[model samples]
Target: MSYTDDERIRAKRRALYILAQRDHSKKELYDKLIKNYPPDLCEMVVGLMCEHDLINEEKYTEKLYRAYINKGWGKSKIRFELRRKGLPDSLISQQEEEYDTEDFIDEIMHLVDKKYASKLDFSDYKSVQRVTAALARRGFAYDDIKLALSRIKDGDYDEYDE
Candidate 1:
């Protein structure tokens, strides 16, 4: 679809205004602009922004990944959110380059100690299941949650346990 110069300028300004509020993936920018602009115009505007180094999906992904990790979220949840926000698999895969099962295990343990300590009970099967379910909802894998709970139950103390 052909776009007028005026339409292009307006769309570009709108895109910049939207981006100024916060970082957005190119897909996100296009999605937002499509609400008011034509698809072709959105694409052209986004491409221009990309050419100018204004839209950096990598930086956005890195920031979000770290934030989710610090917030005690697991990789599955992070990937879900990134995809939800319009990031493609290629970009999301970068976060997995140094993947380590141990990283999420530590996060699981932190959540158990900090949030569920008062409620968790290894002896009570129902209590254990409840905690496990909650952690799974937080995107933690079943095996990792079980391992973390076991570590605590067996008195395999870490510094935090002391």
Candidate 2:
């Protein structure tokens, strides 16, 4: 399909409108803009946005990674999300390495404690099962979940419990 000059101009304006609210990767903007205009026009608009620094994959990746971490998401989940956004594998790998493993574990434990530690009886099998499923659904690896559960089982975090 092809777009006329007026359609192309409107596409660029629409792209700018999308960016004014939040940042988007070139691919994401292209995907959205293409719905309104032809692919070629969408590509041109994406290129223009790139030239003007309106779309940046690197900045978007970093900000998204930090935001996901703040939301207590695990590396595996965050990596999958960034990959789906069309980010380079190497960039995602670099961001993964930047996170401290120890801190990641602590974050998982904190999430567990906040959600399940208060009312659930750790001694009960059903409670443990529920907590385990919750951790897995949150994208924590089995080993990390096991370690966090073991710590609770051993009362290692007793001092922090209220």
Candidate 3:
């Protein structure tokens, strides 16, 4: 489809406006611009942005990973989010490999503290169920959730310091 030069210019302007607000994956920017512009125009605009480093997939991926991590998200959840944003598996795996089990456990613990007010009493079956479900919903691994629950239940929160 042939897009008018005006459409192309509008697409570029819209892309920069959105990028000024936040970083976006190439696909994300295309999807947003294509809502009002032709697909071809959107693609061209995204290509231009990429060529100029205005739309860097790697930079966006890393920034997004760190943001999710700071928000107490587990790797599984963060991976799902990045995938949904149209990030390639290879890039996501690179960031995933950088973190260890301890980092994930620590994130889960921080989530528990923040969400449960650091007063999770796993002694109560209901409390255990609630916290466990919460962690699972956050996309944490089964083993990580299980270990975290056991530690919290045993009042061994200090063990996560390492």
Which one wins on TM-score?
Answer: 1
Q: Model 3: per-residue lDDT, tens digit, 52-134?
A: 99988887888899998897788889999999999989999989888887788877776776677455665577877777788
Q: Global lDDT of each model?
A: 0.87, 0.82, 0.83
Clashes of 3: 0
So what's the TM-score on candidate 3? Answer: 0.87
After superposing candidate 2, which stretches have Cα over 4 Å from the reference?
A: 1-4, 158-162
- Models ranked on lDDT: 1, 3, 2
Task: Give one digit per residue, the lDDT tens place, for model 2 in 123-148.
Answer: 68888888778777777777888887
Worst lDDT window (10 residues) for model 3?
114-123
Q: State in Å the error of residue 46, model 3.
A: 0.6
Error in Å for residue 81 of model 3: 1.2
True-structure lDDT of candidate 1: 0.87
Task: Supply candidate 2's per-residue lDDT for 90.
Answer: 83
Model 1, residue 54: what's the lDDT? 94
C-alpha root-mean-square deviation, each candidate = 1.4, 2.2, 2.4
Query: Candidate 3, after superposition: displacement of residue 9 in Å?
Result: 2.1
Best by lDDT: 1
